[model samples]
Target: MAAKGQEFFEEQRDQSLVKAHIVSKYFDAWSNVMLGVRKQYGRIDKLAYIDLFCGPGRYTDGSKSTPIMVLEHAIKNPELASLLVTMFNDKDEANISSLREAVGALGGVGSLKHAPQIHCSEVDRDAEEMFAKTNLCPTFSFVDPFGYKGLSSRFIHAMVKDWGCDCVFFFNYGRINAGITNSYVERHMDALFGRERAEKMRGFVRTMNPRQREIYILEELAGALKDLGARFVLPFRFKRGDGHRTSHALIFVTKDFRGYAIMKDIMARESSTEDEGVPSFAYSPAEADTPLLFSLSQPLSALKGDLLKSYAGRTLTMLQIYEDHNVDKPYIAKNYKAALNELEEQGQIVANKPAAKRPMKNGQRTFSDATLVKFPALEK
Candidate 1:
């Protein structure tokens, strides 16, 4: 039998499909944004997409994976055709061979300015060292290791240190949860969370229930990334097919809040449920049993209270509030607008458009990015 995770290459699964779509979609949007920048500034000439554990280009079920999806999208866009640089790596020689064949057979591969770079090398500490020394262009790197062996904070940091660089890695949370206290995987855990933090995490999670443990670990990982200068970090959880437990997650790391905002919107759209317009940022299969509905109101209510308290006595435009408050939060721009609108209706806050501007939607005055909002201070 094939090793774990290799089976998915044989036949794509639902979670894999979701993950691939999210990555490809983000790349499409991100590249377009970069293209716009290039046109305006004439400085950004090349964009790169690196996939460290890219599988065979096509699954046994005849479905294209992320590498092909990204290339296909780029091929269609003339600007991306000249500006994009693609790279794919897999340690398995067989997989590499298969990907080479599939890519060679692509309809428009010949039109790309830079041919895709394919490599078969084990990604580990040496690879991390190489990345640290290399100068990367504005790049989006995807690191999707089978378990946790080839993934490290240092490696991810190196990939995103340059300007306009961002990373998304497959976080095998289930393996990590079990491996935390396992002596055999201790070194790997140390590499991922750093030695000091990993040691503390092991003891801290001893008493935490599974839900609490999951939250704590993810927060710690995000903290670690932040400590390494990744200003924004977000996670999209993927639950097991049974919808009972988390199998893994895709964590995005970036220095730019704009990238963070773009990814936030993408993940929000992919989320299985949006409770009160607030996305759960997770994907799980629908369960057979009827689910509870009362808790949905809590998110908007909490957001309203949080915004009122956080911005008390301050007046700022809707865009300003979103840019200032959206880092590391799951509430997208719409959720913020909804919360602010409700606050205005309840007389808890004041939202107004500029005198010189009138923004309307469907013949109704609308709260736009330029709309000014003022929150009254809390009572003493």
Candidate 2:
């Protein structure tokens, strides 16, 4: 293990806390969704959570890590404790040992039907190949490597191949942003983005500015995952503590749109700021009032315009419009609701509510998924 790895656990930094919160919270919600499906449909019998580079259970500052939080969540939910299986692995023996001790110290470890499995193995080609060949339970894998050595599209594709399987991996943007141009790290970069795309990106990014480079790189990565049958890739950015630049991001990948939508809402809640009701989708220490040189803002006015133009003369439920438009979109359902409500109020569109009043939220009328919206046709 490198000194950087050691320094990471010395104290849980602010970014680390955000990262942990995003992962654990997603896992909790994911479990509940899966559990509900199992109870209603009985299509799934087990759900698995695998952490490829799980670290020691606690930071030197005594803050619990994701593994411990995961266990705690499962232990508290009797339904989840019975069906959720966990596997945690780290190349470092010391981390595995510390994790074992930490897991043992948890309050309800004994309640779990299946004990958490711990493994000490390097996450290299062998691990990737093993996962690709084996059939995994509906699994959620978290891959957090020290750098980008063991993380690859092949491994990620394998992790999300099975039904209900999804993955969240750490994208080391700082290292990658530098590595794209450096000849030394070319092999790892190729493995991540595929050989041809990586070579193409290296040349493509040369003429681009910093912001353009970031967007292009992420789009390329998302494209690669989509090509390999893993659709619905979402990234959550983490800025350096100084807020000068982005350090890394957590990329969520899955084949299902429901998983994608669930994660999007979760990420939106954790975002640092919103512009005109649209989330920034980043974590930065800079004050919310600070002016930015570049910002990606999707105002409600723009959304309303888009909806009117795109769905002119068509009658569709709010859910249908959101489902069709939300892919690769920064706007969440709330933004959609706000825009739709404004359009209805202004007589730009007709919103038909259910005959029976739907449940009121915050004691105010709002558009439910079933609300029928009709947009006026474009001017002839």
Candidate 3:
């Protein structure tokens, strides 16, 4: 039995169920590059696409087909087929069945010497073992899932370690808003953050709207992903003027600076289109700009602190920290000093170096992140 027409359209409209963006412009930006890799390689066999939470192949209306359409378009260019392979997985057995049927329908084409190898599965119970079995070095993967539970940081770690591919994941801010703040999520906080971090103790996820809660939770999530080894991540919001909206992110995790540059281009184009009703972004800001009374409610500076914390354990020049972590030299100095001063008062992060003055090119000056030692708290 299939879903009714209206039922299908409703699901297609909201990405919380079926991926709406994939049938939209993000689909174009992602697939064009993927297919181009195949064409450029000329049957060289160096690329693959893994849709981690692929839904059933087509909506009832037939307008919102994704992975199948992507494959159809790529196969048109015979050169691409020789080099590309696609894999799709879903926890739902029905969707997995639909995907295989869809792939089978798109059989041989003229001069399309190679057919894509698509493995449709009901959720990956053990992704690491599957990674080892496939032995495919991927060029790209589409990891758009409905919520946090669909994918795990553990599976993500394996992909980074074993496959070494560029990954695009759906952040689903809605889930973070509705689910993360709930105590139910707290029980599994170790999966979200890590063990050492979880050991630090707290009732962290207080209920909040997506925007309100993200102030702390998302910053930590970014830190966790970094701890899992990811870079060149840009958080993107696709604003559909309909007032009904969804929040998601596209990330590329790779060690090479080249991959970082390509991801920048992809995010810039994806985020900056007229269709999404937003301007394209061209950068990861090097400074958290806080204008007092300007953004009084949700200041970017609040996030600025976590940005600083993420940079801990690394020696950075003022310029380097600004460039790498997105905070101005003045704010870093003031806040860094304020944090240590407060900690010294309450005993949290002990400052190894007392307030000291150093000579600068302009004049005598003070520095905050001058590599201070930790002071252990003494019992009275």
- Measured against the true structure, the TM-scores of the candidates, in listed sequence, are 0.92, 0.91, 0.57
The candidates, ranked best first by TM-score, are 1, 2, 3
Question: Relative to the unseen true structure, what is the Cα RMSD of model 3?
Answer: 12.1
Task: Report every candidate's CA lDDT.
Answer: 0.87, 0.86, 0.50
Put down candidate 3 lDDT per residue, 1-380, tens digits, no spaces: 54677544443364332234433344444445555665676443555666777777776555435677667766765555665566677777777677677777775633345454445554444664675355556546667666666465555555655433666576666565565436677544566567555444234544444455554555666667778776544454433323234344444455444455445444444332221122233111111122121223332334334544565444444334434443211122333433434444454443444434333333323444554535333334
Model 2 pairs whose backbones collide: none
Best by lDDT: 1
Best by TM-score: 1
Candidate 3 at residue 278, lDDT? 20
The clash count for each model shown is 0, 0, 2
Q: What is the lDDT of candidate 1?
A: 0.87
Q: What are the per-model C-alpha RMSD values against the true structure?
A: 3.5, 3.8, 12.1
Q: Which window of ten consecutive residues has the lowest lDDT sum in model 3?
A: 282-291
Encode model 1's per-residue lDDT on 261-353: one tens digit a residue. Answer: 999999988887777878878877642122243124568899898898999999999999999988878899988877887787688887775
- Kindly report which residue pairs in candidate 1 clash with one another: none
Q: What lDDT score is found at residue 330 in candidate 1?
A: 81
Cα lDDT of candidate 2 equals 0.86
